[model samples]
Target: MRFQEDSIDSAGFVLRKDEVLTVILGGGKGTRLLPLTEKRSKPAVSFGGKYRLIDIPISNSLNSGFEKIFVLTQFNSYSLNRHIHRTYSTNSIHQKSFVEIIAAEQTVSSVNWFEGTADAVRKVLPYIREQKPKYVLILSGDQLYNMDLSDFIQNHLADSETEISVASNSVPEDRIYGLGIVQTGENGFIQEFIEKPQDISQVENCRQQDGSFLANMGIYIFNTKTLVDVLEDLSMTDFGKEILPKAIREKKVKSYVYNGYWEDIGTIRAFYEANLMLTDDIPKFNLYLEKTPFYTRPRSLPPTKINHAIVNQALISEGTILNHCEVHKSVIGVRQFIDHGTKIYNSIVMGLDHYGYFDRRSGKIPNGIGPNCEIRNTIVDKDCAIGADVKLLNLKNYTEYEDEYIKIRDGIIVVPRHTTVPDGYSI
Candidate 1:
């Protein structure tokens, strides 16, 4: 399972755009993210400062020169669909290169919605088979990481006998139970695959020599014929739970070890920590690399206006205006307006889309952080209206609590999209 460097030129192993078809699975309910996924799909949820979660994989594929991509969407996919349509267009690159979306639709062949990851791909096999891809690249939409897909494909091509190759990484011991565990032999071939083993000893047995266990990264490279054959014979709903384990028993599967930063933003605590990590002095994952930069829709927003505002160690997105505010260790999204005498600490203020639309049209309080509010350890989702003198401190340390305007998870207050906190309110 080792690639012979001399057999293949490392300098010229280029996976052509036409040779591969990338399928991005973006059809999750994202129940863990709750209010954020209430209106939009998980992949459509905003991430970092300005980009969506879907941008990571799409950008990685494009940067690796694989342009034929199909994003599979289901469950509250309006915003996700709109974002994809507005952002990605393949006509400029090549006539054959495109980023098309194949949503869950009712047809004569199948009337049910996608059940899981495997089912999602199974339902869209018709569109994928039509492309006639030599190797199919399957990716998850909610994970945040940068990878050169050509390298993964090149490794798979080097071992031409293997029908499947999976991308894996060494994960910390505490996170073993949350991910699928891969047991690889000495030759780098997958021997056993366990999906979320409850017993700690099962996870411990799979630990590598480096003290980290090999966790599945959810990135797979499959031979087109083998993929179709497996799908046709299996009635499994999920890949990790059923398809992968069965594939390991039958097909020749190999593991490509990735020693890089990868985060699966699947839960509220995970999302909160990942966002706050950007404010650190030296972040584990750097998003500002020029060689392989992250791509997103370019909003020609005005420069952030700061009028005597004291901010520290924060990621401030474009078009935000802060007046006489003290923001410490926070992230301010696009078009956010913080009025005078507001103090926000360890919080995320997702800005509004328009200015005074709610106040002018409906004569309600303006959409954004109003004057003299103090927010601490909170995540304010998009288009939120905070009336004057509102405080969201989470004093009770409620592990989980939900109300009309707020939902606290793991001590972080989450204000859902379009929610309004009336004047003089306190949480």
Candidate 2:
């Protein structure tokens, strides 16, 4: 399904598809999400089960009638580039709608990669100028949320005085520690901005009537001229830390409050929890919403086959074979093979890229969990081979631990991609 190319805003103004250009920031290094980002970029990391992190923002933009999207990527972008090309490339019929990948290049003028988020966009101003979009909507590629950006664009257009509009969400004081906080005065116009405040008292006045502070969602709608003017200073790299604070002080910046489920899948723990949350009866971020469905690369695989598996509160994707295993509150990704007697609880098993029948015959520790294995509070990345009787329970409850095969961060065990756990192995 496609959104209309033209629509009327709330203030009775025609909104054209070319008016806005969407830029999704494929994050840098992604050190926090280690192993997962080891081989692929942050945006290319698998999420929920079948979809990549980049799919979220691109899906939202397409659903919101803004299709001229540019994904800025730098480190480990091969998989990201391929995924975008395979999934988002439109047919020739939709000439104006395109999802282009703009990788950081070393030109004669500059011999460096993207310094930061702001710098990444600044470097791609030449490509953006070609589109001649009136507004530029910047979004994070690693966030999980379902937002109607049409409303966000409409809100920004409703107020002619506003040059930049930031999407803000009301979060508790304790949750605002590592998030950008904004203080808004009359008519929801932002008065001050602080990035990742160490002290809560620094923005005490920004607290709302409900006692929640407005935290930046890292979603922004900027006027093209305003964006160009602010990025003139090359030293200002990050939007949250530098560009936003300066914009608030000088320009008419307003906060568009977003009351929805949003999660930053930046760390291993956060990624694990966010995947588990989807197993809930009524998940905050609904993937089943028919109107705003999450888009991904479609696969032509057989339906999942479960042979008397006792599944409860789990989200198991297609092409999986569960043989008499008990799955409780877990998210099983695509093409998984769990043998009989295995019990998985509070875990995320990122299934294989392809069937391992040939690999199984070769006897090189076939992908997927073997029989009698016990997995609890763990995350198994793609193409892993867990042998029989292997236990990844993290029984000692260590805050942090690492070895050649596995890592425990924030008490959750993580078996990195392409790892093999031998028989009877225990953690």
Candidate 3:
């Protein structure tokens, strides 16, 4: 449904603009997305050629008119913090609206770091309480979707009995193992919930009539009182693993089914596939939505200069210089300098952080994919220096391999951020 400027719900409830507080959970060590998360947090990890993973949820919240956001971050959050600070600025007149970052700190009550999702929010409860919100909208920092959160909130407000509302979507049986599955009765009242069940049969009873299972999208709306009560027990660390199931048994947790595009960028394969999918003729995650634009740190880079390049089905960002290159089915990020004779196919080149003027006479290799390089089925992270004649093709089809510079996970080569592959390097 389209988001309306008016805040009146169908149930005739006046949804206050300041009543819903947004809390985006920046993920933990991001172990599954390692190497990429080696230097930056999961949310800070770049995506869609120009935007970071964090931008998705933040943009959605802003578009939905819920601006009082607090991003809870812990592991490797410098880049994420910097990105948020630069991208989102609040109006001085509207002091109530802000996109603030709260990092994990050693408090007098607890000296340890955040254990899980619930723990992260629990530690920041004091700050959240200060917002004086009636309801709290929780989001994951590393997800991709354009949701009308105002509608999601309205659904929760529609039923006074709903203490918690979980945004869910149907997924095939094969995709249920890594997701939280929910069984719902009439009017989307959740009957049972299971988090990341190892055995498919564990959720056999939760399967829908169409053979798909209702999987939690990791988006939630909780009454302020309910959130505080559920998080009172410090032992309940994770929302999915510990808190959610317990709440499901006692509280009136409803499910709001989202039929739009949603993807959890949890692993290297998922990340690689999602970026490549953006190169599709009509991608599932549309970046061109006028009302719900994917917001990021706006750069004033010059338009991409394609010098006689044969490009097809690619999303090339601004300030990129493609010199006689053949880019097909790729997402080349901003400020990329692809030299002549390089061919990037089925890959994601997260371009340079900034343009560099290397003294060619100093025998220094610049920070970009040099000429005569062939990168296929790979992800070259930002600020990488790939020299000429380098071929990052997993020709041997190694499912898993790693070195100081590159890693092959699920048969896709990942050159970590700021890595430098010497001239004529091949893998």
Candidate 4:
């Protein structure tokens, strides 16, 4: 059942395993996600109620049998580091596995900070070089998907002549312009690469098969020697817009067309949409596998309860009590308390020392807060005392919502986590 080391051949092809290391890019500030990212880094954000965005790559590494992982982070790294320590600890006394968090400062350099993805790698080149891993696997921290990188690395090694291997996907014409588009030959040898081009229609038609173009999935594997050379050769370090492209010239740069469930949760809308995917009748991804498990520090609480509530397609964490409430297509974090007559639809509620809910109905309390209110199509931030029967929304029924705090985007109310609003006030 172990996918580790030498037992990783589902397709006979295997990768260079002697010195393999996985590095997760976890330092970026997700500005597009605004209010949510304002508090914490993208990788540290809560995902699927119980997991953080860092779990995707880390889980894949663990399941694929690559435990030597180093997450490179900068902003709000404390939370990410804490989570990793709590979940994938390398205490030496208990487990032999190691999944540690490394940052830009981990290197002995006067370099202010990791400038880009490439620069980040450059700063941490000492860490990788110290391990002397035969190959390097670079990954993103804010993506949502389940992948088997063992297959990817094995494929790369089988094509041993290949210098760099990148995972790509088939993106829509409109979405193509947002990603790095590549022209791969029938032999899977990538020819031309474009970054955020203006005209995607022509590019879409230029493709040979089914109007599909290969867009970068932000996943790359590089030979150790090749990586070192590129990191030293390139003045401005960045993988996406720089290193990989330069390495492809005269070098054996290959492409792996990935046809799996993958999503870039870099924005609030994308983050919200990915959670709703769990609502499907038969979900595209499942995290309930015993063999390829996604490990997390368990809350050690009992199962959640439902009493007179319509709970559909939601991932409710341990010790949650839903009494006469309606939570559909949402992610409720650990130990959350859903009071009676509350309706939380298409939202994310994170509950670990987070703020309580509030009602801004109408009072002199900064933002008139209320208690025990009816919530509908509204995202209430954590940690506020809401009064009974107070309404903080102005939708469908209520017309005059206070637009200063929560702006209505596409008819969805986004309540940033952990902001207090006084009771009895309606927004």
Provide the TM-score for each candidate, comma-separated.
0.94, 0.97, 0.97, 0.87
Candidate 3 Cα lDDT to native: 0.91
Q: What is the total number of backbone clashes in candidate 3?
A: 0
User: Which residue ranges in model 2 land beyond 4 Å of their true spot?
Assistant: 1-3, 91-93, 358-363
RMSD to native for every prediction? 3.1, 1.7, 1.5, 4.2
Ranking 1 against 2 by TM-score, winner: 2
Across residues 149-179, which tens digit of lDDT does each residue of candidate 4 receive? 8778766766657888989888766677678
Residue 174, candidate 4: how far off, in angstroms? 2.1
lDDT of 4: 0.70
What tens digits encode model 1's per-residue C-alpha lDDT throughout 1-427?
Answer: 1112122435555445587899999958999888788888889988877888899999888778788899999989998888888889633576677888899999999999999998999999988889999889999999888888877887787765789999998998889888999999877889999999898787677888878889999999999999987788547888888899999999999999988889998888888888888888888878888878888877878999999999999988999988899999888899998988999998887777776543424557788888899999999999888888999998898999988879998779999988889988898
In candidate 3, what are the lDDT values of residues 18-58, reduced to their tens digit? Answer: 88899999988999998899989999999999999999999
- In model 3, the clashing pairs are none
